[model samples]
Target: MSEKVRLVILITAQPGRGEEQVAAFERLAPVVRGEEGCLQYDMHQVSGDPDRFVLIEEWGSKAALAAHDVTAHMVAADAASPGFRAGPATVLEISAESVA
Candidate 1:
């Protein structure tokens, strides 16, 4: 097998779009997990801050992570929030090859 890795996405709100962003991501998770190469898609909120949302993802490979960027759901996630804070989006990935 090629191996697998985890991808983490951190989404920060501009000001007050937290709830909307969370809801948007929530709707996105179900569909994202169904996408090819996606092993796990989970959303998280900061313990103290409601405006910060995080995404935990697992993929089969780096190529899979790259492909996820342009996935229809991603595009929808971008467009889904016609009303997001749109502050910053951080994407980080750990490749299986690096671990071993």
Candidate 2:
């Protein structure tokens, strides 16, 4: 089996679109969670910065994460970007190592 993939996405809302951005993510959560290989898909809003949101996701593998990028829900989310985003989202892939 391949190693699990972890992704962290930071989304910043446009001047007055924080609520809309949150709503969009809420709508997308279930769809993403239902995809194959998805382990977790959680969203969080920054306590001090209402316009900042974070998405923490875990997938079974790199392939699974790649597959998710082409899904209809993702496409829809990309298409609706202008409605809520202040700019391009920041995405990061993470890996962990254990110490013995």
Candidate 3:
């Protein structure tokens, strides 16, 4: 098996779209968590920023993460993203070894 991969995704919702974005992520969460190689897929809203959200995800490997990016749920999310996002999402990928 390959090394695990961790991802932190930051999303900023468009004006008046925060609730919609949260709902979309809530719907997508279970589906993502069920995917092969998904170790963790958790979402969080910023404490003071109603428009800001975060997704913390862990996958079995880089390949698994790549596969996830192409999944139907992710595809739909990407398709609907422009309507809800204020700007491009920020994504950071890391590994324990890299941080050590």
Candidate 4:
């Protein structure tokens, strides 16, 4: 079995489009959370920064994460991003590690 996958995505919306982006994510959240491997899928707006947002996600495994990337809703979000986003999202993969 593969390890779980975690990702943090930073998204910046085009000027004056922050609310629209938030609404878009609100619409998308339920669908994504219902996916087979979805564990955590949450979005948070940056404090005092209306144009910035952060998305945190966790998947059952790498394979599950890969499957998510190709979902119809995800594909549509990618296509619509250019209109609302300032640029491509910054995604950071994460994991818990011990140094001790």
Candidate 5:
């Protein structure tokens, strides 16, 4: 069986553009959640920093995550990011494992 894949994506919006970035993601969450093998795809903003966001995601396997990367919504997001994002996102990927 393939192991689950989890990712923490850190997004920083351009100064004063946080609302635009959040709105864009809000429109995207529903579509992403409907994709196959999407176990979790939730976005959260930093406690005191409106311009900083975190996307927590979980997928059934590496293949599922790969498929997600090329989806239309993702592609559009990438194309539009430069308008509102500070720079490239910081993607932190992790694989499920037994620590005990």
Candidate 6:
């Protein structure tokens, strides 16, 4: 078996457009969480900073994550809100070691 893939994304809404981003994500959550290889898909807002958002995704593997990116829901999410003004686009992607 291969290592799992986890993704963290930090994004900021456009000026005065935080609500738009939030609304879009609300629509996105269910669809993202419904993907076959998705172990988890969570959305959050930064404390005291409504415009700052976070996307946490866990996948069965890198291939699964890649496939999720091309799914219709993801496509709509990107088209609706590009996400983040500036930051590490992908916070991290760790490969868990296999049990020997």
Q: After superposition, how far is residue 25 of candidate 3 from its true place, in Å?
A: 0.7
| lDDT per residue (tens digit) for residues 2-99 in model 6 | 65787777777766666876787788888878887889888788888877888887888778888988987777666656653433345665545544
Cα lDDT tens digits, model 2, 1-100, are 3489988999999987899988998899999999999999998998988889998999998889899999988998999987779999999987734335
Predicted structure 5, TM vs. truth: 0.92
TM-score for all models, in order of appearance: 0.78, 0.91, 0.90, 0.93, 0.92, 0.78
lDDT of each: 0.78, 0.89, 0.89, 0.92, 0.92, 0.74
Ranking by TM-score: 4, 5, 2, 3, 6, 1
* lDDT tens readout by residue for model 1, 29-64: 888788788888888898899988878889877788
> Over all chains combined, what TM-score does candidate 2 have?
0.91
lDDT of 2 at 69: 98
- Between the candidate structures 4 and 6, which one is better when assessed by TM-score? 4
Off by over 4 Å in 3: 97-100
Of models 2 and 5, which has the larger TM-score?
5
- Residues 1-100 of candidate 4 have per-residue lDDT tens digits of 3488889999999988999899999899999999999999999999999999999999988898999999999999899888999999999998734347
**Candidate 5: regions farther than 4 A off:** 98-100
Q: Which runs in model 6 stand beyond 4 Å of their true positions?
A: 83-91, 95-100
Quantify how close model 5 is to the true structure by its C-alpha RMSD in Å.
Answer: 1.5
Question: Tell me, what's the RMSD of every candidate?
Answer: 2.8, 1.8, 1.9, 1.9, 1.5, 3.6
Residue 9 in model 2: lDDT: 92
- Cα lDDT tens digits, model 3, 3-94, are 89988999999977899988998899889999999999998999988889998999988889899999988988899989889988999986
After superposition, candidate 1 runs with Cα above 4 Å error:
80-82, 95-100
